[model samples]
Target: EKTETNILKGIERMRRFAERFALAAAYPIAMEIIEALQRAAPVDKIEPAGSLRRMRDTIGDLDILVTSKKAE
Candidate 1:
């Protein structure tokens, strides 16, 4: 029983880790693209942070602007 619990815990941990890794790979370049799009535009309603999670009902991709506090 203890071995099964440990294995399940490890599998759950891997799932969480994989999610984070996928998001990390996607959000960096996505944010940069969103930033560039914002800079080139003349709109005032959307701010830097608001650029992400915009148009929730839109059919296309989410052009997000993500900010991280981690040190590289």
Candidate 2:
């Protein structure tokens, strides 16, 4: 039935959303990663964006922007 198919589709969408967010790390963990990056190299600018920048309790993934003359 069309209704059943719609229900299944909704369930699938929720499952994908949960899977995407379930892999999040704590805010502290994300900070540790940022610190490590700072120590690893000297960039003109490096900062956390997205949820991490908002200081969310959980971070799905790190979104960093780095500027430097060296590509390496």
Candidate 3:
């Protein structure tokens, strides 16, 4: 029970931090970034995953999956 409480407290702290600094991007911005990446690369598949994929209200960071024929 103590561990669970601690975890919950930690999550609340993180949420406050995110809110305080506005350290998250809106969905549209995330989408734009993904689109830019796709356009820049020879992408066969490009998708946003993680919190973005889950459609969170605010995204801390972007996680993109891209598949391309070009090797780099």
Candidate 4:
């Protein structure tokens, strides 16, 4: 019984750690993209989707999706 409890606790701990790490990753990705856009001086501004928030797991690099429109 004790061994099973310990195993359960360990699994819980691991789950918490993963959640913590996942929450940590999002801001930097958002910031990097914003800064790059600022430096390039876009005709307007870049914006992120409201639902498109950061997630857990390893991020290799910033992934940007762009849509452009011709000037009026």
Model-by-model lDDT, in order? 0.51, 0.71, 0.75, 0.58
List TM-scores for all candidates, in order: 0.40, 0.54, 0.61, 0.36
Instruction: List the candidate 2 regions with Cα displacement exceeding 4 Å.
Output: 1-17, 20-25, 56-58
| Count of backbone clashes, every candidate in sequence | 0, 0, 0, 0
Q: Specify the poorest-scoring 10-residue window by lDDT in model 1.
A: 51-60
Best by lDDT: 3
Clashing pairs in 3: none
**Model 3 error, position 46 (Å):** 0.5
lDDT of 4 by residue, 1-69 (tens): 999999999999887666343434665667787778667654454665432344435333444454546
lDDT per residue (tens digit) for residues 5-70 in model 1: 999999997775553434445456666776775676654443333323442221223444434343
User: Candidate 3 lDDT, tens digit per residue, 47-69?
Assistant: 88877787766566777888888
Give the per-residue lDDT of model 2 (tens digit) for 1-72.
Answer: 999999999999877566344324555565687788788987777877886777765456668777888787
RMSD of 2: 4.3
- Give the C-alpha lDDT of model 4: 0.58
Quote the lDDT for 21 in model 4. Answer: 36
Candidate 2 clashing pairs, residues 3+ apart or interchain: none
In terms of lDDT, the poorest run of 10 residues in model 2 is: 19-28
Q: Is candidate 1 or candidate 3 better by lDDT?
A: 3
